[model samples]
Target chain A: MSTLGLIFRELRHHKANAALVVLALAGTVALLVAVRILATAAERETRRVTRDLGFNLRILPRDVDPDQFLADGHSDKTLPADAVTRLAAAAGTFVSFNHLTPSLERRIQLGGRDAILDGLGPSVVGPGEKKQPMGFNIPSGKAYIGHALAQRLDARPGATIDVKGKALAVERVLVESGTDDDIRLYTSLADAQSILGLPGRISEIRAIDCLCMTGEQDALAQLRNALERSLPEARVLQIRAIADARARQRQTAEKYTAFAVPLVLIVGAAWVGILAALNVRERRPEIGLWRALGNGSVRIASLVLGRAVILGVAGAAMGYFVGTQLALQAGPRIFPVTAAGIVADPSLAWWALLIAPGFAAVASFLPAMLAVAHDPAETLRAD
Target chain B: MVSCDHLVRTFAARAGTVAALDDVSFRVERGEFVAIHGASGSGKSTLLLTLGGMLRPTSGAVSIDGRDLYSLSAGARTRFRASTIGFVFQLFHLVPYLDVRQNILAGVPRPDADARARVDRLIEELGLGPRAESLPSTLSAGERQRVALARALAKQPPLILADEPTGNLDPVNAGVVFRRLADYQRAGGTVLVVTHGNDAAPYATRTLRLDHGRLAARLTTEVL
Candidate 1:
């Protein structure tokens, strides 16, 4: 009879033992798969939540006065509008900053009242990145009037307003915010440059730092170094509060996964090893009989390790299905923002199939060796 | 033919070292039926295992059909033992999961149509036809011994070594087992049986008595 035939018959006779092994393997695989999928979803959710916190890095012209820029909430000194293009074209610029938007902000008189006129240019992202542009994109002939400014100027949606002898249609009225934005009027960069009589100039380039580092890591130093190499004429200023929060959230997620994966593997291996040892103990006489019947060590070891491989394959298939289903069901409740992006990952199935069997075999290695090294004469002569 | 030259086997006990076989020497020609009789702890089983190449003697040597059994590599020795000898134990160490047919087939070194046919004939000759497909757990003690004997003879090796083959059976089952071994001898196969009682005396052509790991006496069947 074939060795496989014997194994199948033995497994059928010892149904409870086989079932327990398969269940242990399945539970380990399930936990790993769930953790992997959920970790990805958590990262996506964090990126979305933090992205909404707004740009935290402002790049101003090197000669700008810090006190004047802070008090006025706008820079008097300006750089060429093409400075945003030069920085975007620099090597490794996106590695330190993203969502590069050029803006020119100034205080001007509108309808006899002082208001902030903010000119927003198109955003340039990293190569091959499909991220949505942050903030508003205003057309050259249109304006987005804030609540206080719209009330003071009697401007509503679809109403044309006069600014510096230029007529611009009001596209939409922004909602009331408690910040200075409530008295600001948004326009295209070309419109602001034309109206201010200073063409091809922008006050600052706005961006968010890409270094997800805590305050202790000196993230500002790294940002400044990267800026110095790429755009020496401009200096970078980072908002500590927002950057620190994003770093802490990302690190916490990573630490959770690092702690979880190994714990599952160790427990899984121990469970498999113990059960395999028990199986070898139960089949002592059978092993002796085979040895006496002229079977070699390879054949004997195959009987034990082959069973583990078979069970591992079964467990991998079952675990992948169950874990994917679990993630699909419970993911949206945990991260509702990117819940729709959660879907079954086919590559996980391939990885599970490749690794689980090898893991089981390694776990059962000592037991298989014990079976091979067993002395047949001991059992046969004792009988 | 089998020959043992000053065979010595020892064990390590808590008290000290003890010898299981002390300078034992013997020989059996081809087609001879020999029985070794000894009391419990007399080392009859140890001597049988040593001769079967399952246990290596502490000193001296054993040669089967002129091949040095211990000098061969472990793998080659195992393959030689598979093709040359058959073994039967007292406990009927049949695989619990396999049925009688599979247990008998397990003995064939390289099973083919001839081996399968021989196994079928042995099953019928030993009166195990009705229980051929039954697992060892459901069989009676006598029937299990019959299956074990059939397994030993299934390969039709030149030599058969039985260690208390009827130790667990009744008088009637013991007689059945001896008669089968005698039949194999009549067909020109060498046979060696080790037992505590004289149950195998009637069928053995020669009997050797062992006392305290030493050969006490040797007698022919007619001398008994």
Candidate 2:
């Protein structure tokens, strides 16, 4: 009989034992694969969530003192009306810039108290536009009154507010934006610019760099540098904290995977090692029988090690397949927004496929060596 | 032919090291059936294993066909045993998953075109033809022994070793096993067997008795 035939028949004789080892190894691999997919999906979702929060860069006319800008929360500094248009031509796919020019504040009697109003004008940032500048844009002659101003004026949507002798309908009472938005009146950009007597100009340029850090480049930092260079006459304030949050979250996920991947494999190896050791002990008589049948130590060792390798390969493949399905099912359930479908991460898949079997081989190595150490005379003589 | 010169084997016990074979020496020529009788722990099984080079002697040497058995490496000794020796045990030691035919076929170092025919003839001659396809677990004690004997003869080795080949068998089966060993000796094959009972003495051309790991010098006798 061929050696392969003998090995195969031996497996059949102890099918249950072989199956037990494979099952344990497969479970370990499956868990690792699932976690890998989860980590990838979470990192991707972090980026998207970070992007949707809003732009971290503000471009206002240069040479404005930070103290003055903070005290008034208004700037007479203006960027060219065609600045965005001109920049668009030179911008790569990464740029997402927009324009907004708040009207000069006006005083009028509202609920017996002097209230100030400003119009969102020049070119209103639209709702459907990709380069969104904060809230949705209002139509011509329409206004979004701040929550505090509306309370003070005893006004709501569809009410008229006259400022600087121009009457504009209140389109909607703005929710308390908690920042400068609570006390401001917003109108179309063109109306704001016209009312401020600045034709074809803007107070500030609001833009999202669409800047994501990746293998291509440190796009976020690069975007900041590009903006400072191209619009040197404009003050570029880089938004922080949120971008830092995204980066930190991504780092945490990577670290967790780094620690977890090895932990799972070590556990897998341990479980398989225990099983292999026990199997070797149980098969001592058979090993002695083979030795007495004139098989050498190397051949005897091969009988045990060969089976371990085969089981390792088989278990790895099965675990990878099962893990993919589990990740797909569990990910969506755990985090509906972030956990996407199966990520075809070739490296992770390769790692799972390669390492699982390698662990099995290592797990079985001691037992295989021990199998060879048995003296055929002593083992058979015991009977 | 096989020769041993003052062979000694010791194993470490929990108390201390104890010798299993003490200055034992013997030789067996071709075409001889030699039976060894001893009480349990008298080292009859150890003697068989040492002669086959499965166990290394603590002292002295064993030579087969003029080549020092222990002088060869482990791998070479294994190959030598496979090519030159066959073994039968009391428990049959047939692989539980294999059928009788496969068990018999396993003894050959490598099967050739005539291997199947040889195996078939052995099974038929041993009256195991009807049960050849049956697994070892399903065979009767007598049937199992016959399969083991056939396996030993499958490779056509010049020397055969049997350790208590009939220890677990009934008298009828024991007689049959001895007869098979006798037949191989008559056909110019060397056979060395160890049995607890004297029933196998009639089948051997010579008998040697061991006591306390030492051969009883004056007890060696030629069977008449």
Candidate 3:
């Protein structure tokens, strides 16, 4: 009979032992798979929640007065519009910053009332970054008028409005945010520069900081250092509340996975090793008999290790299915914002198939060696 | 044919070193059924294992068919043992998971149709046909021993080493085991049986008495 046939028969005879090993392997794989999928969903949820908190890093012209800029929430001085491009093109700039939006914000008279005119340029992103742009992308002649400003001007969607002798189409009315945004008129950067009589100039660049570090790590210092090297003419200001919240959320999720994965792996390996040892112990007499029957060490070792690999494969398949189902069922309730993005990752299944068997084999290696090293004379001569 | 030259196998005990086979020498010609009888701890099993190439003696040498058993590499020795010798243990060490037929087939190294046919014949001769597919656990002590005997005889090796082959059987079962070994010997195979009792005396061509790892006496079957 083939060695595999023997192994199968042995596994069938020792169903409880085999089932326990498969269970341990399956549980470990399930925990790892669930952790991986859930961790990804947690990251997505963090990004969405933090992105909704708005851009935390402000890149203002270096020469702007700090007090006046802080009070006015807009820089009096301006940088050339291409400064955003220059900063984005800088090496490793996106390592600390993303979603770079150049804007010219200033208080203007609209329909005989004071309103903030916020002109947003096309967002400059990191090279090869697939993240969706954060803010609106308005056309040259279109505007997204604030709720109060739309009421004041009696403007509706697709209505034509006049701004400094230029005609602009009202694209949409913004929802009331109960902030200065309610009285803000948003337009394309080129239109703002034209109306403000400062063509090709932007007052500031808004961005979200990517340095997910705690306050104790001095995140602002790192952001400043990065900005100084990338855009020497601009200085960065961080909104502490938003930056800290995003940092804590991201770090918490990372810390959870970092602690969980290794713990599960260690416990799983120990469990497998112990069970393999027990199996070797139980089969001592049979192993001796095989040795006396002229079976070589390779054949003896294959019996033990082969069973582990088979169980590992079964565990991988079962765990992948169960874990994917768990994530699909529980992900929406946990991270409702990115629930639609939580789908089964086929690559994870392939990875499980590749890794689990090797892991089980490594764990069972010592026991297999013990079986090979057993002395046939010891048991055979016992009579 | 098997021969050993002044073989000495020692075990390290807490009291001191003790020889299991103390400079003992013997020879067995082909087609002979030899029985070595000794009391418990008289080194009967040790001598049998040493000759089987399963145990390496502390000193001296063993040759099977003129090839130095210990001088060969471990792999070569295993292959030599597989092709030249078959072993039956007192405890009937059958693989618990395999049925009687598979356990019997396990003895046939490089099993083929001829080996399978021989195994079937041995199974029938040993009266294990009804229990062919039954695992060793389901078999009685007598039946398990018969299966072990069938397994040993399956490969039809020139040498059969029976270590207390009937130690766990009743008188009737023990007679059946000796009869099978004697039949194999009559068919031109060599047999070596080590037992604490003289249960194998009737079938043995000659009997060697062992006392405290020494050859105390040698007697021809006519003396019995």
TM-score winner among the candidates?
1
What class would a CAPRI assessor give candidate 3's docking?
medium
lDDT of the candidates, in the order given? 0.91, 0.77, 0.92
Please give the distance, in angstroms, between residue B97's alpha carbon in candidate 2 and its true position after superposition: 1.9
Best by lDDT: 3
Instruction: Compute each candidate's TM-score over C-alphas.
Output: 0.90, 0.78, 0.88
- Residues B1-224 of candidate 3 have per-residue lDDT tens digits of 99999999999999999999888899999999999999999999899889988899999999999999999998999899999999999999999999999999999998999999998888898889999999999999999999999999999999999999999999999999999999999999999999998888889998999889889889776775
Q: Candidate 1: which stretches are off by over 4 Å?
A: A70-74, A109-115, A138-179, A182-184, A212-225, B222-224
| Tens-place lDDT digits, model 1, residues A1-383 | 88788889998988898898888888888888988999899998988888888888999999999999989988899999999999999999999999999999999998787899999999888999998898889998999999999999999999999998999999999999988888998999999998898799999999988887754788889999999999999998887788878888888988899999999999999998899899998999899888888888889999999988988898898888888888888889999999988888989999989998888898999999999999888888942
Model 2: pairs clashing at backbone N, Cα or C within 3 Å: A56-A239, A120-A187, A120-A188, A120-A189, A121-A188, A121-A189, A121-A190, A122-A189, A122-A190
Better of 1 and 3 by lDDT: 3
DockQ of 2: 0.52
User: For residue B144, what is the lDDT in candidate 3?
Assistant: 99
Task: Give one digit per residue, the lDDT tens place, for model 2 in A1-383.
Answer: 66667667877888988888889888888888788888777766665566556545566778667787667665657777666545544444234343332334433455666554554434333335553345446788888888888887777888887755667798899788676566677777677666667777776665544444444455456655766656667666656666556556666777888899788878888889888888888888778888888888878888887777778777888888888788888887766666544455557567766776677878899998989998877566623
In order, what fnat does every candidate score?
A: 0.56, 0.58, 0.62
- Residue B3 lDDT in model 1? 97
Number of colliding residue pairs in each model: 0, 9, 0
The positional error of residue B171 in candidate 2, measured at the CA in angstroms, is: 1.8
As a TM-score, model 1 comes out at 0.90
